[model samples]
Target: MLVPLYNHTVETPAAFFLVGIPGLQSSYLWLAISLSAMYTIALLGNTLIVTVIYLDSTLQEPMYCFLCVLAAVDLVMASSVVPKMVSIFSSGHSSISFNACFTQMYFVHTTTAVETGLLLAMAFDRYVAICKPLHYQRILTPQVMLGMIVAIVSRAFISMTPLSWMLTHLPFCGSNVVLHSYCEHMAVAKLACADSMPSSLYSLIASSIIVGSDVAFIAASYNLILKAVFGLSSKNARWKALSTCGSHVGVMALFYLPGLVSIYIAWLGQDMVPLHIQVLLADMYLIIPPTLNPIIYGLRTKQIRERIWGLLTCCLLDHFSQNS
Candidate 1:
């Protein structure tokens, strides 16, 4: 048995063992390979998005600015969990120090909230560009954009702070084994010797409020945007406006659907869904979105696509010239 961080007098364990997926120990090799592949793609894709946007002056609009933030959030979200998860599956070294686990938990939750906020911001950007074209620049000026990003990050930190705080206060005795991949809030809380209802309830409520409200606002923005698009007399204009939003809408669906499913399974579907499926969904929720966001944007958004193609062409030419 693993040694406890403190003697019987203590409440928390020194390290927690993470079981990647319960009852699937035999599949650890394949699981590790899959996660490692997806994580590599996520790192490369999001990094390229951020780099292209930063280097290309023509892409320095509000939409691209928010895309850069979204890429950055995707990077943070994937980095927070995937490396340790891959290690757990590949090496059977599932032990995570108490501080490291909480830190991972904080980054995972905070980046999730920040991503939701960014989606809302992007939706608003689309709405302004489509609905109030004349004021797009004025409405989302450098000052306003900066303020929005700062507020989104700050709000996430403030809201998610309680999750870790509540977990810390609870008395964790006995088993330090976390059933899910990483140190998820509810997973760790359930190990506490004391009643964990409050922590669970708080997490559910906070997630609901943050995701629910942001989604509602995003819906409202798109609703107005649609109305404005239809009002346009030119068919080409309508298509152009919608094409701009297609990537954002796709990204939102990719993010919110899996996230909601994971939350539901964690909070309510314990008896309905198998434990392994629930853990898989939770892992995919973090993995899939980050892996796909850049692909969706790079292919759907014309400017980004052209810029990426140019960059690739330059690299290929440089490599051939060096060989010659």
Candidate 2:
């Protein structure tokens, strides 16, 4: 039994749900319509985040600054998932050409990796503001922030490039079907006929390079944050600092938990993720964070709440004046 199990190869793979649709329970109709709505909301939601932070000079600080970077990462990640989903649902076929699949895989991983690093950056930003206020300006200057980001992004691109290249070299002689939706490294790697041990090792390395480094940095940042927040002289200042970092904390948890789960299910669990569930979770990372992050942050921030109220009041006044 062990021998057969060890020697077995997966031949036929098919995802249960159609892509780019909403309401996963039923047929493609609802899923397509739902995903369409999600994409629209993700686009508008993250765009508003970027625009609000950009348009308002008051929000140009390090906290909101990191948010702008988050919004950008969300946009890239959303673009990778939403369009392909729409294509599959609208067309009734999940047919991604080889090049397109790899391209999508590359960017999807890139944004996620970028987000992981960016979250650490934000955490460090908070630690500085609370822990070392004296050196905050010197530590997180415009040139410094920009330079750090450039280095992180370039590093992510360089590190993940080998995984994609390694994957491209692998031969897919058997099932072209990717078990779960999208060309996930694990999902696609399962199809490779050659020795994907290197690819698998690379996957472990990639996970460590991205998640491991980010987690370590984030842990260090938060440790300093806890120490600093506890030392705050003012009660209100402590609360304010905590509130500023809350959305980031939430975003980090949401992004990382599922990611850790996915890596487990893909490499260790080995096809245990029911196709439908995997699709839902796959899209959740893309759809949920982008839509919810702004709302969470806006509701939490006094400035954002006041701005939203003011915008609504202006719209109502405009409508009444026009009609009257």
Candidate 3:
């Protein structure tokens, strides 16, 4: 543990190699193409969401502001990993510098933590809007929304900094080849020659604390929402209320379910699970949510759907006029 202070002189590799889907090494070209497509879609979708929200004054509500934050986070998160993943798959040049690896780890965790906070904030926004409509505006004022964003980012930074520091301080004397497409916490931790117990425990505890609490809060908020929806005498009102929450529920499920499954597979199926399967699950955990989030929101939320249609129509009309 204390070896980090003196280990600079030790023969540690300056960079670590990312072994992306060891079994698919023969078809990395095809895999790269597929992943590139997904990355492109994610980038386009999230970018469109952010841009539409910004340009459409009607979407300047607290709910859409939180959504913009989510899309931005998703963009950063996808950007942080997918480009490197593409490079590794296409060129087979998977070497990432030690400093760079830690940086990736930091950003991945930080973005994930921040996204969770944003989801919770979204839940709160929904709760206020649906349950206490009168005070919704009062509760989620501009200052409060700004403060929530600041708090979300700040909390993620404060929480994940120590994990990165711990990883940096660990002495790595083992093979520098990481067996995944990205720099995951446990994957990197397990590479250290030092006792990785503390790192493992910290990762588990931190994830459990943050994820658990966010899930609980979101669940509680939804419970209240459900109660409010059911309490209404009108069946149409109930359906409308449920419809408003459908996209959020879909997003929350998309974000968490695969994540939980990936964590279990990574932890429990380390030896039994095929490397490709684990890699796929892990990649899905990261990419799927970002890729689908915008689509779900745009399709399920009437306001966003109409706004997107209007924007697309405007673009097409402009394009035709310019050509004419």
In terms of lDDT, the best-performing candidate is 1
List residue ranges in candidate 3 displaced over 4 A. 1-6, 24-30, 243-247, 264-269, 272-274
Task: Estimate, for each residue in 28-47, the C-alpha lDDT of model 2 and write its tens digit.
Answer: 66667777887788787777
lDDT of 3 by residue, 133-235 (tens): 9998899999999999999999898888878778888888779999889988878888888887777777777878888899999999999999999999999
**Least lDDT summed over 10 consecutive residues: which range in candidate 1?**
1-10
Clash totals for all candidate models? 1, 5, 0
Which 10-residue window in model 2 sums to the lowest lDDT?
A: 1-10
Query: Candidate 3: global Cα-lDDT?
Result: 0.85
Clashing pairs in 1: 5-14
Every candidate's CA RMSD: 3.3, 6.7, 3.0
TM-score of structure candidate 2: 0.80
TM-score per candidate, chains pooled: 0.90, 0.80, 0.89
- Candidates' lDDT values, in order? 0.86, 0.72, 0.85
